[model samples]
Target: MSKIGVEQSLTNVQDALRAKGYDIVELKQESDAQNVDCCVVTGLDSNVLGEQTTSIKGSVIEANGLTADEVCQQVEQKLRH
Candidate 1:
């Protein structure tokens, strides 16, 4: 499971990800000056969780108001190794 906090309108994005079999642990709404918004999604591998490892962690920051595709692409590029 992962913690995913997002703004109001990005529910579609969240839903889409969940449909793809992601473990969503949490979600929250946040405000921003520009329509562009961001959400932080954190994921941990099973081994890390089982071992209670604090060193292994991952995060993705998804933004909106800019093109959703672009935001997602950027997030993917940044987060994926």
Candidate 2:
């Protein structure tokens, strides 16, 4: 199972991903996102400072205006590549 980093605010998404058999890691801090294959965020704090930092090479899935299922689908697609 691929590891996934999920924002603490997204409880629904965490449950949905867990049901799908993915290894879910709660992203509490900057280092929490380390080693995960994909990350799910609420898109609230991203790009706020207009500065980008490269901590992980995996894809970042923004959970804004999308359902858990849709986010899961994107996670799958991103992992495939």
Candidate 3:
């Protein structure tokens, strides 16, 4: 079971990830990124999060302009270990 943390604003991403069986977690200021398998965000250079986005130890995925399906495909590829 891959644990995935997602930005709170991306409801479509969250639902898509959930449908794919990935555990979805809401991103918050104090959330522990080390505990998750991956962290999904709109972008690493997001003005909303600033420079604090890279705190996660696991793979960090930028949603960018990709659709939820595209995001899911990326995650699935990254999660293969």
Candidate 4:
């Protein structure tokens, strides 16, 4: 079970990912991403991620403008690689 950190502003994608068995964590601050394998975000909001936006440890997924299914697909692919 991989953990995914989602920017707080992008909560819409959380439910969809959670159903897929990914452990979702709300990324309110940099510390929240410590244990996550990937960070899903909407590129529209840089401030929402603080400094973590630029230097995320794992893959940084830009899900903005994508549907929930699209977002899930992107996340799924990232986890695979």
Candidate 5:
């Protein structure tokens, strides 16, 4: 699965993704970098869901923190496969 690290609040992003019909497998908050918050999303690949093992990592850096809309847009772009 592809994992994405968003520079924003996980709650906000998760809610937005759920609203967009994306299944949220997991959400984790990690340490901040330069005062910028970060969160990780697991289970991103459609092929890997309840199947073979796979991993991908994506990062989004936003100064004021990423918005839910921005996170969904970026994730959609990356998950186009």
Candidate 6:
């Protein structure tokens, strides 16, 4: 299973992903996302500083208006490629 970094506040998403056998890493600090295959954020502070930087090589999924199932589907789709 691929490793997934998720925001601490998103308990629902974490549980759902874990149920699907994904390795979920609770994102507490920036370093926690270091080796994750994908990251799920709340999108509350995405690009807030208007600065572009690459911290991880994997894709980032914004869990703003989507349900846990939808986010999981997106993760699966991204991993397929």
Clash pairs (backbone) in predicted model 5: 1-54
C-alpha lDDT values of all predictions: 0.40, 0.88, 0.80, 0.83, 0.45, 0.88
**Per lDDT, what order, best first?**
6, 2, 4, 3, 5, 1
Minimal lDDT window, size 10, model 6:
46-55
TM-score of each: 0.38, 0.89, 0.82, 0.86, 0.45, 0.90
After superposition, the stretches of candidate 5 with alpha carbons farther than 4 Å from their true spots are: 1-9, 28-64
The clash tally of candidate 3 reads 0
Candidate 3 global TM-score: 0.82
TM-score of 6: 0.90
The residue-by-residue lDDT of candidate 5 on 16-77, one tens digit each, is 76677665544322222212222333334322223334233444323135566876776776
- Give the candidate number with the greatest lDDT: 6
Error of 3 at 59 (Å): 0.6
Query: Candidate 1 at 25: error in angstroms?
Result: 3.6
Task: For candidate 4, give the lDDT of residue 6.
Answer: 87
Cα lDDT tens digits for candidate 2, 1-81? 999999999999999999999999998877778789999999998852234664777988999999999999999999999
Off by over 4 Å in 3: 44-54
Compose the digit string of candidate 6's lDDT tens values, residues 11-58. 999999999999999988777788999999889987522346648878
Clashing pairs in 6: none
Which scores greater on TM-score, model 3 or model 4?
4
Q: Which model, 2 or 5, shows the larger lDDT? A: 2
Candidate 5's TM-score reads 0.45
Candidate 1 Cα deviation (angstroms), residue 49: 24
